[model samples]
Target chain A: MPTSLAPVSIDELKAIAKRIRAHIVEMVYEAQSGHPGGSLSAVELGVALYWNHLRVDPANPDDPDRDRFILSKGHATPFYYAVLAERGYFSTELLKGFRKLGSPLQGHPSMKALPGVEMSGGSLGQGLSFAIGHALAGRLEGREFRCWVMLGDGELNEGQVWEAAMAVPHFGLGERVIALVDRNGIQNDGFADQIMRTNPPAMFAGFGWKVIECDGHDMAAVDAALAEAERPDERPRVVVAHTVKGKGVSFMENNPGFHGKAPTREQVELALTEIAEGLA
Target chain B: MTQAASAAATREAYPYALIELVEQGVDVVAIDADLSVSTMGYQFGEKYPERWYTVGVAEQNMVGIAAGLAACGKTAFIASFAVFLPGRCFDQLRTSVAQPRGGLNVKCVASHGGITVGEDGMSAQAIEDLALATSLVPFDVVVPADFESAKQAIVAVGKTTRPAYVRTGRPKVPAVYGPDYRFELGKATVLRTGTDVTLVACGVMVRAALEAAELLAGEGVSARVLDMATVKPVDRESVIAAARETGAVVTAEEHQTTGGLGTAVARVLAETVPVPMSFVGVDRYGTSGKWDELLTYFDLTPARVAAAAREAISRKR
Candidate 1:
């Protein structure tokens, strides 16, 4: 059985997250067509998982018993590819090829194209079901690898997400699967609450999942929540990570305009400077 | 000319074939919606309860789950109504199963194809399933003609490692092929030979095309029959040969004319032979009725197919 890595100290994880955010900004700026707001918001969550929680080896990516991670909010490819690259699944140099025509880092995550990506995703509401697929397969094979899936708050509006929510508990896969909702509260057009109000914690709890809430940007809180999720229970677990749309850069933070827009070169420099200053 | 005395429903053979695969040591898992009893997935579940999954009425989730299972090195065979498998889960099929192309062996065997669904009406019948399944590039689409063929197709799909959509019917059509029939993917079976016209068909319509060939023979017109079981990656060699040998062609299926066998055959002929062709298929939505009445009402009968063949042969230049 694959084991999780030694927990990185909170400060070290925060620094790693800063570098990851820098990569996210640079990649999106280079591509000129990628989602940065959600990617930025998901920085700590991604860093914490790949660096500390997930039982994956950069050297042996295809290890059958390694923990699986799926980016259900697929538009956040900038964040996901950055985390994988930072963790040495591939070179961080490939981050520049994000969303390029021939790059393996497609605009959306594709499992066939990339070695580390667990499932192909772009259309919303499909990832949780796919996570359940991995969990179910693990249960049947008597494998100990855990499956983690991350979803955007607005993506919960898609009917298929609820369908999967209802199914996971019915199959009693609470212990094997852990879902994280990036509660950035923003979507493509506007605020998710304005578009379609979905009280996620209540919604998931109603569907019979054990719901946990935490500050998504706080490295320690997010780490603790993930740790709690792995504790065995009869119901599937979901961590409703409350986060800002863009956490590092002041201009883009809490701004829906940056949801699907790439950062300008100047904006990238500014975001990097802000992230660097925070590290200082 | 005598048809088989007792017909066997293709749905009836699904469970038996699945069980055979499981017993043969194939790492096969069956997933079904709430329609297991109707789709005949219950028998497989009853026998191998550990490998079967009943996902209630959610067809979209069923396909996604199947993709996940396939991702984990399990050959997942998912079954549902033909209308819901590709109809309800086309997007999931495209991204999760087809686009990844990781050798995800998710075989979707959809039952209740076409108006043969009988008395359940338009909502239950899936006339455009072939079109929908074929539109997803690189998907193997097969509509087997009878019980023997359905069983063989299922076992063949289990041995192969590609995503496939096998459309079966609710009605028990006459056995066109015997138990000794060998099923091959992407190859159309030539059932009869003639020079006047070629009658090409698939699904339940293959039996109609054979009976039509007999009807044409009675009228001094020689008609050939080709059972085009695989709709996608269609046997181009056989279709072109049929058009060239018999200067005209008639395509029949219990589906809409727009994207079914007729459209597939026409595309091939237009590219290769360019023969005069007539289509016999349902041009509109189906309604509640007996299977035979619906076939006649949709002009999907031996008489209509024979008429189309004669008309096509006359238009041959």
Candidate 2:
């Protein structure tokens, strides 16, 4: 599993998040096909989990007892790939090959294609159930490994999500499972609220889950919410991190146009410059 | 033909085998999306509560959870009516289970396969389940003819690491094989051999085919019988050899004529030896009735198989 707690400071995490944002921009720009808006929206959430909370080891990716992170909102592959690469699961150079043939970095996260990926997910609302499988198996095996899954707020439109939401607490798996929702408020067609208004906090709480809402772009708040998730409780925890559609880049922030579109070369340069300014 | 004087439901045999696997120390977990009584999966749950999960009436969630369990190193056996599995959760099965290369060790053994589900009506009968399951890559699809083969097939799939889909029926079928019969994943068992024509069948139709061979024998036509228990990764060599030797082939199943055993056999024959062929299966949706009544209603009887076999033989060049 993990060797020890994250040794990096808050400043280091911010720096890492900035670099991750840069990688996401460049990866989508090169692949010319990926979901960059959701990718950017989930950068800080990815950083907080990979750097501060999850008990995963890059070297021993297949360790049975390691904590698992499933991207339920799997369209955010650029974000997931950047996080895995930043965590030393694979080389950052491979980021250039995202969405290409023979590249381990598929447009969607595939478990067999990459070592760090815990589940193959592109179809939304299914990852949480898959995460539940890991948690149920851990309990059966008498292992203490925890499972973390990230879900998109708009992806809640799928009824299967509610099915899993109802199952986690029913199984008494609250102690070993945690879910993070990226409430970016923007789906592909339009704003999430305008498309399908599923109040995640109320919905999850009604399903008997412990809900934690935070500013997803704020690294410290994301870290704090994750820390709270680690506290012992009788209900499974959900950190509803409020995020922007295309965070970091000023032109794309809260813009649904960039949801699944790649940034042009000029847009990439501008996005990188904006990200570097955030680093400062 | 040897009548064993005993019969059992394939659905009943499935859970019996699951209990055996657990007793034999196979680390398997069973999941059902309600209908446990019909699928007979509740027996496994009642026996081993720790290793069983019933995910309400949600088939999609059940499939995803099963894939997850298998991915985490448990031989997860998810059960439901055949109509609910591939019928309601094809996307989950595709992305979560089958799309993964070398598939997860998940065994989807759905009961109530084909029109043999009987009184439940057309909605419950899964005529195209074999087509949906066999369409996936690296999935071992098997349809056991009788209780003994169903028992052995479940245990056989549990022992292997590959993903598989085994379709079983709700009705008590006549015994086609005894305790000495071994169930292999991709091998066809030749129940009887002859040179005039071949009768290939699966599930309850295997019994019908055997009876049909006897009828053909009475008419002075030497007919061969092959029990095609495994539909996907189908025994191509056996099918080709039968076609090459007999020059006529008639496939029988308690399923749709469009897909199921007929389409699988046609693919092999069309690629290898082109032979005169006919299919004796349900060509339309079925209605609510008794199991035997539906069999006659769909023309899935021994007489139908005999007539189809003769039709194929008459067309042989």
Docking class for candidate 1: medium
Residue B78 displacement in candidate 2 (angstroms): 0.6
* Candidates in order: C-alpha RMSD to true structure: 1.4, 1.5
Q: Please compute DockQ, using alpha carbons, for every candidate against the native two-chain complex.
A: 0.77, 0.79
The A-chain TM-scores of all the candidates are 0.97, 0.98
Q: What's the TM-score of every candidate structure?
A: 0.98, 0.98
Candidate 2 chain B: minimum summed lDDT over ten consecutive residues — where? Answer: B1-10
lDDT (10s digit) by residue, model 2, range B11-61 = 898789899998899899999998998888888888898999999999999
Stretches off by above 4 angstroms in model 2 are B1-5
Question: Using alpha carbons, what is the TM-score of model 1?
Answer: 0.98
Question: Residue B144 in candidate 1 has what lDDT?
Answer: 94
